[model samples]
Target: MRLLSMITLALAFSPFAISQDPTTQSKIADATQDVVPSETSTQPLDFWMQKKLDYSTAILRGLAFSDFDLIETNANQMRMLNKIEGFVRNRNPEYRGHVHAFERVTDEVIRQAKQENIDGVTLAYHQLTVSCVRCHQSLREAE
Candidate 1:
């Protein structure tokens, strides 16, 4: 009930208005369709897990696949990390430990990425995975 109430309040405060504008409405609808969970996704917990997975995949592509240089790569990942941090903070206050762990990792990753330290980026990626696992475990337990 508390979760449902929070969701309602968040929706109420969201900047994106339900638009009569067809183009804007279509864009929102498309984004919603793009994010629809697979049938194997079980609950809200699984939904968030999938989101984290998707972020990780995007980060990997930005790191490995993109032609962007190291600074650009790290900068993009840093922005992504910040976005994930904000999302988790708003949606999962109970997972503070996991959030803090990822924050530290992201900070170090950004610092090291700036310094051109390949190993630091690698270690941060590993830590990111661990942080996700820790939170997912906690979320599953809560369910």
Candidate 2:
């Protein structure tokens, strides 16, 4: 009985148990591999932008398959990028607004991913893309 209880408890808390399905794990691995940069890359923008694009692609793939684990992994990556020093450093007021909007939308994506809400995640992802476009346009106009 004690052995049975221990096995049950271990299964409940194990990361492997949570994502134990081979198909799901494969999708997650494939999606992650699609975006991660080679070790030699050093530019912050290049790293973050690649990650952003990778995560966006992962999210779409996850949505197609109803793979919440893939969505959560990529959403967490986006949230991690929000903490990067370069991502937060902006002196221009308009650009700062765009940054804040991006952060907020990314947070929403993370939240929705955690909740496994496909519609919410999709909506937040769209908002994040719009924020990126708006920020880029502002930068071009400034230049």
Assess every candidate by TM-score. 0.49, 0.63
Candidate 2 lDDT, 1-143, residue by residue in tens: 35334433543455843654776555544543443333334645466567777778988888889788777777755654443322334648887787678878888887897888989988988898898899889988999
True-structure RMSD, every candidate: 8.2, 10.9
For model 2, give the 10-residue run with minimal summed lDDT. 80-89
Per-residue C-alpha lDDT of model 1 across residues 1-143, encoded as one tens digit per residue: 45444543553344542432566445434444333333333565456445556656655665574322443333333434344445544556667666667777766666666665666666777787787678778878978
Candidate 1 wrong stretches, greater than 4 Å: 1-51, 62-94
- Local lDDT at 14 for model 1: 48
Compute the lDDT for candidate 1: 0.54
Off by over 4 Å in 2: 1-44, 85-91
Give residue 125's error in model 1 in angstroms.
0.4
